[model samples]
Target: MPPIFRAPRYLGASAIAGRGALPYLACVITHARWTSQRWFASVLIAMVVLIAVATVVGAEMLSRTTEVSNRLNDRIAPARTAVAELTAAVVGQETGVRGYVLSGEQQFLDPYAQGRGDETRLVAQLRGLLEGHSDALADLDAVERRMASWRETAAEPLVRARRSDSYNVALVTQSKEAFDDVREPLAGLDSKLAALRAEGRADLNDSRRLRNTAFAGLVVALLVLIASIAVLLRVVVLRPLNELSAEVRRVAGGDFDHRVAPRGPADLAVLAADVEAMRGKLADSLAASRQQAAELHRSNADLEQFAYVASHDLQEPLRKVASFCQMLQRRYAGQLDDRAQQYIGFAVDGATRMQQLINDLLAFSRIGRMYDDREPVDLDEVVGRVEDTLALAIEETGAEIVRPKLPTVPGDATLMTQLWQNLLGNAIKFRRPDVPPRVTVTVTEDAEKYTFAVADNGIGIDAEFADKIFVIFQRLHPRDVYSGTGIGLAICKKIVEHHGGQIRLDTSYTDGARIEFSLTK
Candidate 1:
């Protein structure tokens, strides 16, 4: 396979060995995590570049817009104003010349002199305004020449003739013709200025439109980029994560046969591969565990059946042995020696104890298959019955059993009774001589179950024997000292376990032996 297609190595030995989900998850994350980081970084950089480019384009557009505004404000508008002023000055000259030629009055001469002064000032201003405009400068020169001709050839000569009292009608006609010649050029200059102003306005409009377009494009690009990021996040991250979460839930729901397929980006795909691998290993482990448990259960069932049958069968022989031994002891009491009578007594006691041991074993084995009609058993009622049964022992030992109101729990009535009977009997039997057996049974209830503590102010069990005491036939005291088959607490353990609760010696209790157990409520 190509390098890109090759599988990633796990970070730890456990991951490579396909152990539990934790290592697999860690390995998958380590393998596939950074691809998303790089992807995000690339997108961010692209956005930055796009913003920078848009900014540059917008700046250039704004600069062009400003240049257009300056052209209209500074060049075209002022030049047009200068052209209008010059035209008015030339018109005034024509007006003055016509007046002098017609009346030859001194006031008309004053008007003529004023027109010349106005012309000089306006011409200088127009020249300055049109300094860089070659076409406007040519137009200004033509106007200047036309005005000079009218002033010198027509107005000046006619004015001189009239002053000397030699002015004629022909001179007046010539001056009028010269003044009319100036009108055409002034009209041309007006058209030129109007065209320049219109062109400046058009250029300004185009620049503004360009700037608007650039801004609109920038906005559209940013919107598109944001939308793209949202889409990418959904596709590459959210969707895959949701799918993976659902897959995990299915696995958690005990669907060991369910498989996770590789999907999404390379990293997520690798993660999926790791999860699938873990799932397969877990499925195998669960299958093996279930197989072992089934075999163990069958073996225990067979053992229990054998024990029940053997103990039931042995009881007849044990009874015969004890009866025959007692008959011998009674019938031959005087005839036999004291040693012979003691031997027979020992045999009887041995037979009786063996029978009791067999009976205890039978009871223990029956715990597995006996309780078929399980229901809610009230511990208070069960403890009351236990107290009744152990009334003789409690009275003889002067035991004070303090049992508070107890919660009702789901269990078998017979088994619950047996459990309490065994525990209370032990408390009564194992009392300290100095103190009356003060056995207190209390219950604490929580959401899931009820925890019961049977405490007694008796000789407490040693810490080393806490766990040992719950095993069948495991007794801390000798049979003569405790007078039991050593299976009472073991029976309690079995019953609690069968009901899906735990029974343990409360090692934390220092004053006495506190046996705590729980039952599903």
Candidate 2:
């Protein structure tokens, strides 16, 4: 197929896709604009980045802090180890002295020699530990001097007592007392250094805790920022877009009068201005069009009235001329030849039929010309009057008219009566000879209108001739076959239309015809 022929399908598909995608796209754009205005969104993102950076920095700081702590801890370990060794040396020295006093053995002197050697090592270790702090170094110096004096004083007495093979208890007791003095002061110095080491560990723990708290606070700030951004986007962007969409839907659904106020970002202001301009243009164009339509309607009404009056006036003269001609033909037939009489009769018949046709045209034209006054008309009563007028026709045709209960409607009573009379009479007149006319009138009511249906079992019109039947002088059958002026249905159409209603053929065939009309209730 040619692309041109496929154009309509492509256009329809494109329109459908556009309609489907527009709402989603609008929502996305609205959300994006909202996000742009969200202070918290930007803040949240920045905070997250900052928190990540801080986390790295804090981790590095923690590592360095821990290293410092470890170095401090390492310094304390050796001093503590040396203090323990010296205390053991003091105990061994005391035991050795006691052993010499009791056994007089030279093997006991071995401990005394080891103790003297350990005394020098202990002093050197203590000095190394106290190298950085003056107060701690002073305390270590005091402890060292006491240790040297006690060792010097206590060891000489013990050696002399052992060499003489006479162990002096008093001298040994004095030596033990001096050794206690040295040990007690050394233990006090060790306690002070141990307290300092504990303080350093506590500082390390505090630093680590502070770093963790900083990171946690940063994370919390980031979370709060993100939440704030989300709220801003919803209020600033989504809300305005939704309002615009609702207004647009109203406009699409034939409410072109609707207007949307500009809101949200600056971009929407331009759109709102354009929409308002379009609305104004449409309103102006509609007003001008309505004015033109009113003028045309007035001209049509004038034309109809003129035609009705002209035709009605012509009908009386034409009727009289036909009646006189017919009288002359009947009265003077004996004096004239057969051909002359026949021609006169034909002229009279043509004039009489033209008169009838003119009268029908006048009736059709006068449907709503002088009958604008509307009053409540009982359709049932109208139907009864039509039945009375058509009683002889109905009897002759053996037609049965069936009607449902009808309602009172606002319309010209005379026109409503005529409307029913013409429709019902047509049904009876257009009956098939072999079958009795079965005409039924049904009524249906709605909120604003009432529908009246007149169905017939008769010589129904062809589908092609259905609309033609309503036009003036347009006949489906010859005058000899169907006696009609051919303006009945046309009058019915005009009457219904004048009352703000419509009339149409519901169904029609050679055997039957159903006609329906509606009027405002």
Best by lDDT: 1
Q: Residue-wise lDDT of candidate 2 within 163-185, one digit each (tens)? A: 88676777788888887777766
- Candidate 1 least-lDDT 10 residues: 1-10
Q: Write the per-residue lDDT of candidate 1 for residues 330-370, one digit (tens) a residue.
A: 88888999889889989999999898888888788778576
Give the residue spans of candidate 1 off by over 4 A.
Answer: 1-52, 96-132, 148-181, 201-259, 314-317, 330-335, 365-369, 372-374, 445-451, 461-468, 494-512, 516-521
Supply candidate 1's per-residue lDDT for 321.
Answer: 92
* C-alpha lDDT values of all predictions: 0.81, 0.75
Clash pairs, candidate 1, are none
